[model samples]
Target: MSEPLPWYKHFWPWFIVVLLLGVIIKSLVALNIAIDNADSLVSDDYYKEGKAINMDLRKIKQAKNLGMQFLVKVEEHQLIITQHGGPQYKAALQVSFIHPTLEDKDFNVNATADGTGAYRIALSNAITGPWNVRLEGFDNSWRIQQRVVINDDVEYWLN
Candidate 1:
């Protein structure tokens, strides 16, 4: 009879080894992805933040009582905001752009009104996707927040 082949030289052992290696490599890749892209939407201090909701609502109420309205538009890299019926705010407006999922992508811009409630500021880059925007007075006495999706051609109304 012909000599039998050694286990290391056999086809079955090599096939089984390759399958295990593939699973191991795939698991390593998945682990790397999970570590790098951890979730950022949850707040660490849930109790404190929850208690602060009423304060935020009070600010919104102040804005509403003052009849504040904003018309927001994005033109190229410029963000244009016009106040409709707010007080003659002497201080600059602070517009916050909060990314829905990624905290690093959030930013703020300050724009001075042109004596006619018209304000403009240059954005660092083009922004897309969903966002939570907060428009606050310079002293933070009044504020309004809303969720908006960025589109180059769309106009947003905030109150």
Candidate 2:
């Protein structure tokens, strides 16, 4: 009769042990990654935001009642805005570029319309990625919002 091999010297036993250890190590690594990269997609004041939805809807309705239409385009580092079928006013419009996840990257500019209905603003840097664009009249009587993913030069129309 032959003597049995020790557990450490057995190929089948060591192979099973190594396989289990590998799975454990991989799970630990995945857990570390998940802990380090916490999601920040939720706002801290989500309740307040929910409460303000009605006000935002009212603003949107005001814009619709005024028959507001706009054409937004970028050209040579400048933002061009053309208004159509909107009430004429001599006030600078407020244009806000809100980053989806980063508040520090948000920017705002006041665009004054030319003698015609066209407005222009010079951009010091290029804008890319996803942005929530909010355009409001100087009097705050009307507002329009749009979500745009800017990959390259493109045109956006709001009505």
Candidate 3:
């Protein structure tokens, strides 16, 4: 038999090299993806956030103690709120619509008293998605918030 060909001429060696190169390339692509899509929900100030959460819990408790209940309605281009049960809230309501992922889509609507315990606000844009609605008084003493999916439904109850 002729002298064995060099190792570089063998099919198995070339196949191994190709697989190793493929793995290296795939790993580089994964590294690039990892760097691009880093976790963003991690807060830098954990202690401060924890303390603030306690404060929010207190505010929520206050709202519950006051027996605040609201019925939010979406009518075409206007949002209507009725405090069906409460101590007759007279203050203007500050409603916050928070998007779970997109910060740019987050907005706030200031609803003024329509009549009696009812409030109304004109929506500047049509909003349809999963949103966190935070209902708070103008003075910001208490807050009621919940995750809701806004669709064609006309009425939503917040307790």
Q: What would the TM-score be for candidate 2 when compared with the true structure?
A: 0.68
For residues 15-131, what per-residue lDDT tens digits would candidate 2 score against the true structure? 999999999999999999999877767679998998888788888899999888888887658888888666765689999999998877889998898887688888887888899
| Candidate 1 residue lDDT tens string, 85-137 | 77767678888999977889989888798766688888878887799989999
| Top TM-score prediction, candidate number | 1
In the range 1-159, model 3's lDDT, one tens digit per residue, is: 789899998899999999999999999999999998887767899999999999988888888999988998877777788887768888788899899987778888787886565787777777788999999988888899888888754799887
What C-alpha lDDT does candidate 2 achieve relative to the native structure? 0.85
**TM-score of model 3 (CA atoms):** 0.75
User: Model 1 has how many clashing residue pairs?
Assistant: 0
Rank the candidate models, highest lDDT first: 1, 3, 2
